[model samples]
Target: MNIAYLPIDERPCNTDYVRRIADSSAEVKLFLPPQEALGYKKLPADKEMIWKWITDVASEVEAIILSIDMLIYGGLLPSRIHYLRNTEATLWIERLRSLRKEHPGLLIYASNLIMRTPKYSSSDEEPDYYEEWGEHIFLRAYLQNKKQREHLKKDEELQLQNLIDTIPKKYIDDYEERRAFNSTINTSMLKLVKEGTLTFLAIPQDDSSEYGYTSIDQAKVMKGIEALRLHQHVQMYPGADEVGATLLARVYTQLKGKRPRIYPIWSSTLGPQLIPMYEDRPYQESLKAHIFAAGCQLAETATEADIILAYNTPGRVMQESWDQSDKDITYTSFRHLLTFVDQIKQFLNQGKQVIVADCAYANGGDKELITLLDEERLLDRLLSYKGWNTNCNSLGTTLCQGVLGLQGNKQKIIENIIYHIIDDYIYQAEVRMKMVEDFLPLHNLTYFNLKDKVALVNKERNKRVRDAYQLLIRHSFETITRLDVQTFAPWNRMFECGLILKCEQSEVSKKC
Candidate 1:
């Protein structure tokens, strides 16, 4: 299985993982187009140059993994050079269609642009239509239309909500519109797969950030993948550096028939507030208690935690107050975390598996955090800490890569990672029970079906679970193991003993 991977940019974790996986494969090549190079402030304006670069790379490989964002647009950075509509996916689709006509046996797996809320503001730094006259013109048109309405009041504020809502929500969510404007760029690649123009089509899971929204129902998109029968033997993971690594490793190993060395990098902060914005009263209260309990456990048994999830809370005054003249102590805490990164890198360099998930709660602080830690010579000690604003997406990617190296088959690897995830949940519950004794009964009494158990467990834990699970998952990736009695004995015995004792007391009271 000859493989070729084209990462969107250098900072992308997917490329890094793919590189590692390629090391274990017989024939795996990496092709990062010059226009899509990392840290390139702007892509080339010449459309022919871009097309030539993409075609040149695609021409060499039997299978290609292309980032739709990089291929159609330039990068996720909201800049004129990174614009997608102008560069266009239609050309790429045509090129791939031509390729399929030439070599129908070739495989192409491409990721679609799943809408995500854009964090970095291109308008803030660049003079664009949206900045110069787009908002103003829209506002003026809205006001003029309002004034012409005889029954309308003139006091209405010229707000974005009032103007943008004019465009119907259903229209925006329309499948045809999504495919045409965004999904088509990626789906067209898959069309090649369906028509036997390509062999395997892997569509990456896109987050809300791609659509310029805070959140999205990824399940809906996933349902579409299922409906199209694209889920069968298809390798799909959350598109992050680590996930790409894992998927590539699994695919490569399967093709090469050998185990590969796996290395994981973890970086993140934990001090961020539990509640960013309040939505539900009950949920907020529960979250606060859970965070406090988790914090107390972290501070007390920091060593027990595989990875520390830390972040600076928003509101500079509050952050300052939290620091409270303990700069040295705070610095020392971060240093200790960096020490773990260094150690993990050492293990990886020694040809052992290493996983790194750096948590950044308040966005855009990872660079400063990395700088501070590097001042202590910690960054040099690790293999990679390549991005800013680390999140769950990166963590999941790393786990996928690590698990992939350990497991040969893609679906089996996913199942194994999930199984370890279950064990991780039980471990955390045990920790929580130890920290807050009152919750022990609740934890023990909760009963979920197999499917519900997996879902519920996944929901409760954050990135830390990913870290710990990866450690154990590396051990069980290839083997089929049943849940031993030991996994449930502790909680089950506690519940059973409690129930029996209560029943005996009730009988004695009745006899008395």
Candidate 2:
């Protein structure tokens, strides 16, 4: 089977992840555009080039998983910053209509992001002037939505107006107009889904909040979906990047006509209550949504489940791993992390497929968990694992990969598992993050954005980091998998990497 996939960006989670997950599940081919055509933090992808690529090759594939946002605005970030009139936006959107007309029977699945109103003062992911007024803009959106949803007292109303008045009218006007355009384009997408132009649509909330302009925009999108009776095909949730994985899992499950059952085991009592970073809801709610989105059922008991989701939730508060539970920061205890490893070991002994969501702390792997798991030689035993981005991203991605690992060639599956372990766990949660903090600065760069002389610096810095990663990752994987797999960051950002694993166990040199 051949599947044409258009990722939101060139990030690991959106691009190679789709390839790795699909490769593990079935013997299928995924066609992706050249890396240059997909956008990055502030770089808009070459949309016209990608459209041409898809047009030329899409006829051969059985299905396509596209990012509707990417098709129209180059990527999720570009979607928010792009200045386009309705007519100009419609010209690009109508390309999908043309696609449907061309491929009448092809299954088309796509996802769009609900623009996030960043709460920070940094313009890393926003427009330039946002660095000055981004936080204020976010507060205004939050207070406005909160005020409209419930009510503000006379004093509170006065405060809200005062806050709005402080923000430059130009900034507020640009932000509002951009959001209104995004919201309008999204609803127009629904009309396509309603007409069967799209087989499935997933609208993931990007960096959502409880009370913000995105929340209000979400309500408007939901109303349109309901009005068209497209709830059966459209899924609105609080997430991004994970959408591609979820949609791919859905396609895999539907093709097999089998819905596996997943049972979640939380190491901490407050697991469900704690809301991880960049999300609006608690962990359990997002897990359930992701499970359903992946075409899987939730089992009440582990005994009835085909896969087990083991989360390293915090005991008191979820602290960043780098913080080491210091200075009032929340963290899971050493004893609890040890106990959690024992639980996963028990599952492996019980002959059950276990996928570890190692979010004992967010943004990286639980150091103690990885250390102890390595000492016990249990990393290779698990079905899958994830702990890189927000809690929602880690949990959903691990679930999707685990669900897909249920089938496929055994040796091939093992290779795929090792790949995921390397990328999602070791590289993301451990090495790459440290490199971002320590190594990148030598070239005057930070993880969030590039400093002066981006083009030349990015190239030299990526080489330096990638070379160091190849060395460090070699040692890490040796302790776990005992395989010296060749790894390279194709995009030169250390965010997404390509691995060429050779099967030494087989008589022929096997490519995995």
State which candidate has the highest lDDT: 2
Per-residue lDDT over 129-225 for candidate 1, one digit per residue giving the tens place of the 0 to 100 score: 3343434433433344445443245455535446556644443333224334554444455456556655554444332221212123244445555
**Superposition TM-score, candidate 1 onto the true structure:** 0.44
Cα lDDT, all candidates: 0.37, 0.75
Model 1 stretches with alpha carbons more than 4 Å out? 1-3, 9-29, 34-47, 50-62, 74-91, 119-180, 186-190, 196-220, 232-251, 257-352, 360-387, 396-512
Cα misplacement distance, residue 221 of candidate 2 (Å): 1.5
Stretches > 4 Å off in candidate 2: 152-159, 325-330, 333-335, 409-512
Give a tens-digit lDDT track for model 2, residues 297-348: 9999989999988887766666664554261233544226667778888888
Instruction: Please provide TM-scores, in order, for all candidate models, with all chains considered together.
Output: 0.44, 0.86
- Cα error of candidate 1 at position 122, Å: 4.5
